[model samples]
Target: MEQNDGLWQALDAMAGEATEYFQKARLLQERMAGITGTAVTDDGYIKVTWRDGGIDGLEINPRAMRMGSADLAETILRLSHEARADSRRQSDAVMSDLFGTQNPAGIVADKEGLQESIDMMRDVFTGAIGDSKDLIDRLQRRLRQD
Candidate 1:
């Protein structure tokens, strides 16, 4: 029947799209994994390097030591926060660019049947930002005690 043929064609098209989406996402993930970078504070006393999900390196200039313990700590904390925020922002941008505003697995594949999956990702990013901010605040507070 023509209806049966049409159904198969539609399914085939969807399968192809899904495959492309996954391949692209995987490529982006791999590209992101090896990207390492550093950020420096305005005072030139603190620098932080990070890759993937953790701190890769840290450098504290001798100039910061002259600022006393508290100032030195604050400078380091601020630089760390800046580096983390910058990394997260970049990661989010990459995800957004790769997935687009409408998630391929959601709207493109099943026409809203996967809305929950999309919602879950949004929650994940929201929670990540909240957690990152909390962590930065904690670090700042702890450093201020020095």
Candidate 2:
């Protein structure tokens, strides 16, 4: 009976921690979804906005039309790349703040990290429930024998 009480206490503590971890992960995802990045050409001829892994907006000055087709296309591509890099940096910063890690890539909970966490939690709860069921069976058997 004493052993069963200790096991229940441990399971309760783990469940509480798992709940807190899940809430924090959800908050991080929401923040990352809302983040955006912007970049403007050095000549101020073009501007690009990046949000949620896609370009959200763009602006090109009329004077930029003077350039040949290739020049204009090149400028847009360069600005888009810059905007993407800016967005990635912003994302890294947010992730770093949340996880408190100096290494961005290591701590960022990408698809793999999120999946691993979910799997681990599932396994823990599964094991706890299985243990409780086995314990109850053993207790019932002992009571019947008595």
Candidate 3:
């Protein structure tokens, strides 16, 4: 009975430690909410400003506006996705700068595929769809044969 009691006490202590850690992380996140990062498309036609949650603003080039609405919309969609990816990359860089080698609590996990989750979350957090690099590659190659 004593051994069981001790085990439960230890578990309770660990849980308390975890809770404290999470609280500190939340504080850190709150403190970081105001900082912003800018991500421009590779072509410089679109620029997106983002923070912890989603895009704060978007700017489209006049050249982009010349296209028909459907074409402009598609291009905008693609650029938005790219901007979001760049935002995530920027966010990771900032977080790494802030946290060093330690993974930020609630932002990432210490397991395989966690990086992928981080990448996905970055896009989700920015409210953008992730690029289909594979599809782009295939289309690029197929269309180039003409």
Which 10 consecutive positions of candidate 3 have the poorest summed lDDT? 125-134
As for candidate 3, its clashing pairs are: none
Better of 1 and 3 by TM-score: 1
Model 3, range 14-53, lDDT digits (tens) per residue? 5896787687577557656655657665677777776666
What is the per-residue lDDT of model 2 for residues 1-146, given as tens digits with 9 covering 90 to 100? 77678778988897896787677688789988988788898788899999978889999899989999999899888888899999999887877777664233663547677678679879877877877898999999999999
Measured against the true structure, the TM-scores of the candidates, in listed sequence, are 0.64, 0.72, 0.45
Task: For candidate 1, write residues 20-122 as lDDT tens digits.
Answer: 8889889777867866656897766778976777778898877767788887777667766777777777776676678777544336568455777679768
Candidate that beats the other on TM-score, 2 or 3, i.e. the better one = 2
Which candidate number would show the highest TM-score if scored against the true structure? Answer: 2
Q: Candidate 1 — what's its lDDT? A: 0.71
lDDT of 3: 0.64
Model 3 stretches astray by more than 4 angstroms? 1-27, 41-43, 105-108, 112-146
State how far residue 36 of model 2 sits from its true place (Å).
1.0
Q: Give the residue spans of candidate 1 off by over 4 A.
A: 103-146
Sliding window of 10 residues with minimal summed lDDT for model 1: 1-10
